[model samples]
Target: MATAPLKRWVKPEIYPLFLAVGTAVGLCGFAMARNLAANPDVRINKEDRAAGVLENYDEGKRYHDHAVRRYVSDAKPEIMPGINKYFSSSK
Candidate 1:
C-alpha cells in the first residue's frame, strides 16, 4: 500500500499570493542594492584607493584606470594563418 506524505502542500490560491509577495520582496531588494551602489558615501572600491588613516578618498578614479587600460592595450595581435586570415584582414 502507498503511504501518505509527512506534510501537506499549500493550496493553489495561497501559492499564487506567496509567489507575488516573493517577487515584490525580490524587486525591493534589487532596488535597494541599486540605490546603495549610486551613493558615494558607501564607496566600496579597494583598488586605486589612497592609503592613509584619514587620507582624502576619491571615488571617481575607480571608474577608469590608465594602468588597466594600458595593460589590455599591450596585448600582441593574434596571428591567424591561411585564407581565413586574408579575409579577416581585408575587413
Candidate 2:
C-alpha cells in the first residue's frame, strides 16, 4: 500500500523531466533543418563590369589627350592690345 502511493508521486515528477528533454530535442532539429534548406543562388558579377569600365576609362584618356594636343598645336597667340581696343571701342 505504501509503495503504490510513492509510485503515483514519482510519475508526476517524471512527466516534467520528459517534457523538458522533448522540447530541447525539437528545437535542435528545427535549427538543423533550417540551415540545410538555405538559398544557393546568390552571386556578384563585379569583375566583368569592372573590366569594361577600365577599358572605357583608357579610351577616354587617349581621346582627351589627342584633343588637347591638337588644340595646342593649332592655337594662335592673341594680340591683347587689339582685343582691348576692339572691346573698348565697341562699348
Candidate 3:
C-alpha cells in the first residue's frame, strides 16, 4: 500500500490570544478558591453574635496585635535604617 504525505501542523499566528484566555481562566479559578476558603460565616459565627455570645469578647484583636508587633520587629532592621538615612541625607 502507498502512503500519502503527512501535513505539517500549522502554528497559529494569534497564539497570544490562547495564552491570555488561559491565564484569565486560571486567575478566575484562583479567585473563586480564595473566596470559598475565606468564607466569613465559618470564620466569624453570626449566630454567636446574634446570641450576644461575643458581645464581651474581643475577637482576634490580640492575635492581630501580636502579628503586627512581630511584623514591626522583623521589618524594623530593614525599614528604619533606610528611612533614617533618607531623612538625614535630605537635611
Which candidate number has the best lDDT?
2
Q: Which candidate, 2 or 3, has the higher TM-score?
A: 3
lDDT value, residue 16 of candidate 2: 86
lDDT of 1 by residue, 3-91 (tens): 33422445566788999999999999976885567434444666423432433346434424445576867765665556657877855
Per-residue accuracy of model 2 over 1-91 as CA lDDT, tens digit each: 8899879777866998989999999989875664444312211356644554343556455544665587877656665867776888955
- Model 3 CA lDDT for position 54: 36
Find the candidate with the highest TM-score and give its number.
3
Q: Candidate 3 has what TM-score?
A: 0.35
Model 3: how far is 17 from its true place, Å?
0.5
Candidate order, lDDT descending: 2, 1, 3
Q: What TM-score, over all chains together, does every model reach?
A: 0.34, 0.32, 0.35
RMSD (Cα, Å) for all candidates, in order, is 11.8, 29.4, 9.0
Off by over 4 Å in 3: 1-10, 41-91
Which 10-residue span in candidate 1 carries the lowest summed lDDT? Answer: 1-10
Model 1 off-target regions past 4 Å?
1-9, 44-91
How many clashes would you count in candidate 2?
0
